[model samples]
Target: MDTWLKESRKRADSAHHVVPIRSGVLWSEALMRQSMPPSTADPDTSRPNRIPPDVPRNMHDSYCELLLPFASSPELLEQYINASGGIRTGMLMEHLDSLAGGIAYKHMLGPGVEVLSKDQGFYMVTASVDRLDMLAPLYPVRDMRLSGQVIHTGRSSMEVAVRMEALEKDGREQTIMLGRFFMVCRDAKTHKAAPVNPLKLSTPEDKQLFALGETHKDRRRLRTSVSLDRLPPTSLEAEELHSLFLHVHQKVFGGYLMRLAYELGFANAELFTGCHVLFVSLDCISFAKPVPIGSILRLSSHILHTTSSEQFPGLIHVGVQANVVDVATGKEQTTNDFRFTWCTDHNIPLTRKVVPKTYKGPCGERLGFSEELLQRTLTSKTY
Candidate 1:
């Protein structure tokens, strides 16, 4: 595990040199000649074959694995999580995004792909986290092992599967989290969606994963078409979300948005279930648009359903909607759709149920579709 971590970090460091060409002019021969002294007109900076030779031009080539040992946190976080003894969900998300990006970079760094070209470089952003199923809880004392791989690729999008595992003291590894991220590749120069290499399936596993990706994409489109967050919230649920709005005056961070969404969902879960809960999973999350700085962001968390499991008897599903409010115009635009599940604290059984109020108007219909989407996600079988 330690060796894998070292090698992964080494490759990540090497890949850093490829991102600077995003300007589509920085790596130009003419620019390099003009910028460098006569003694060093062109340096052999392109270190080819840095990534593993076996990992090239296929779903197998995009594999990335890492092992990390948790260290003592700083005073602030240490004090905050000391009692709980686990890393924050936000921290986990940051690692997931980073690993997925590394895998995507490897997928785009194969034969016939320009590794360092000013005219072309595949730049990808996390389009959505389609599904994140928490298999178990993670604590700070346990070492973390992460595996990320490209499962499928489309014209300009790639689906990366990332699984989180916790290493137990006795050399046993347990799956703690599983997530699929949809990343869209864009031209570094034009900042427009760009073409990506298609997935070449050579094995049965490859075919299965590819089929799963296709299914997920179709479900995402269907759910997005009838997204309730696209419409304004009904008056009943507005009161709960009113105080959850955060006035963002600075640039929005993806990890920050994820954390906010989780907090809102968990809060609503606690409210409806009347039980202290911990975040278990997030599903069907979509980032509708880039959130600009100074946008008034609101997270509306609605209780969709509650179910019991063998390990955790009381589990609550909360549907959260992220909206950007235009205070000047008194209008709001839907930005994200998130479904979060929380496990009740102390394994308490939840006897209360949160039955959503009926929506009879157009907004109500939108919310109705939203409930159906949540139900579908809850019942759907995922790869």
Candidate 2:
């Protein structure tokens, strides 16, 4: 793992050779060179420069166009369903993260995060991708081409327009997806935000995609506010958190733990439909001991109190625990816990009356606590 990370970092630091054409137009010959492996021919040997034959142009001939068929594949759908509880939102988040890393990086010169404030729900059903990892009847690999260029940049955000299409398919080529993604990049270590370097769009096609991104930004801003309170709660174990840690780098991504908290609390809500994730102001999560993977994680949540002045109710607290068993020594370990708070939507009044003192689940066990530490470690910040 350490070696892999080192090699990845080295590749990220290498300078890219940018080829200059007309003013405001730059292309990376280094990217093309890297796409091909080193040739066996001697450097001094003369080689013939042959003219390539003309190929039929397809309507979907774009970088992001390559990604569409993969996104639409039945095999890819099956893999998504199997991995994360068949929840489309989770699967879409994972896919957007993958695309943002690939296409978004093509426009940004450095490593960055594309914080997806809005949901990409069912959008990929028609989007494009170059390679689709259908971890199906086992995973199968398909290759396609991607073309992405930067459209706009702001104080702390940048937008990239991407197009993907099939390059060498024995079958028909189709327009699977076309869209723009807005990204907010930050310094990896400091977490302070940064701006994307100015991009020079050379093609009319590139200009068109950039314009689309500008128009889409307004709709995206509104959708970002749409709450996902209708989804049913899902459970997780300590082992799952450990497994998640192995893959995710961002602390915000690790907030899947908090997602579990929301799930637990909303399930127990007297008015389930009225519950929403109003805000998470501060969080200070710590792992006292590493929970083994595959442990049954149980979570329970409830409204501790309510507030009239606030946008939502008072606070919703969620408790999480892991059910673990030692394989070598054969002993059971229970009780790893965390808490979360949520506010109700004041604009939408609750129709159901609140239930009185009827909370259920394991209670009164200070399984892991220290007298010296009176306050909880995890905290949240409200919006």
Candidate 3:
């Protein structure tokens, strides 16, 4: 971990290669990257590069930590302070995204490498985030610690687990949030899939974590096989939705533990609607395709599954699927799916059970087989 800390310091003190931030030309820059002939502008994705025989790394090799001294630095706390005096969770979430990426690079390259330029042989992109659930509510004016490591690896992708902790009043590290991100490697030049260093199961705990990562990957493939765009909703599911509609006589419904940061609610939007809800954990997030410049996106969200623990009213499982449509040809593609969990107020008995009123519109089988994963996430890294 000391070595990991040194890498973090080196990242901040970059002595080589820096690009000046340009003001307001990102739209043009994106256009330049995708511009091409009529038949190739949105050409089918190129073939992914083959996996390379990279050496496997011990689970600890990619471990790293970062700290934000909100307790000691009034000025820093002021920057993250919300209008209502609560700390800004969004700003810290953005930091998590960067930290997860940096950790992925550390897993593939050595922990000492700071700069992430194309010349490093491979580039990494966050393919998806399985979940990032808030274990507990945030406290004001406290220091924050974020740590992560690559828990699982595939032929071309890695599953990275990250946790955010706070120093509690009793001087203990209490986890406030837990998250998992799936990152894939691409050949710097070929831009296809590339092999990542595998995980070395040096201990029983390491083997268990690796197994969970493997389960996560298998769950994703299963979800994809049942995606709404590719196949019709299961007959039984449709029947259930129809029965609910007949009994209620009207209505419909509407979404992540973020792959990026939206684990159990709307993407840290301007309005915080889940006032009575406490975030629990996220199940999974899937990115099916990329949205092009002129494409229009339609998002649909639903509480896919729910359960009551001994405490809260219920642990609500939810999902949001985003689809993109092409104006010229009216072609649509599934872009993303997100699964999240949160505990609502037990005072409201009605909130305990959320029944669907319509037949399935998007896929609804996301968290059906994720109970073990969810429980492990809730209890795994306790202090």
In lDDT terms, which candidate is top? 1
* Residue 40 displacement in candidate 1 (angstroms): 16
The Cα local distance difference test for each model comes to 0.64, 0.34, 0.59
> Best candidate, TM-score-wise?
1
Cα RMSD, model 1? 9.4
lDDT of 3 by residue, 69-115 (tens): 88888988888776656765656666776678778877776555544
Model 1, range 1-383, lDDT digits (tens) per residue?
22232233343333332212221233345645656664465454334443432333556566666666663335534633523465677567766776776677767775233334322233667777877777666667767777767787877788988878888878787777788898887765456566776777766667777788898888776554445555556787565343222221133656578877776676677778775787776766666566876688887878776777677678787777889999989899887777677878898999987665765212223554355544534443244
Per-residue alpha-carbon lDDT of candidate 2 for residues 62-87, written as tens digits (9 for 90 to 100)? 11212423444767545544332332
Q: Using alpha carbons, what is the TM-score of model 3?
A: 0.65
Off by over 4 Å in 1: 1-56, 71-83, 110-122, 221-251, 309-312, 358-381
Q: Order of candidates by TM-score, top first?
A: 1, 3, 2
| Backbone clashes, each candidate | 0, 36, 10
Worst 10 residues of 2 by lDDT: 119-128
Give the per-residue Cα lDDT of candidate 2 at 92: 35
| Per-model TM against the reference | 0.68, 0.31, 0.65
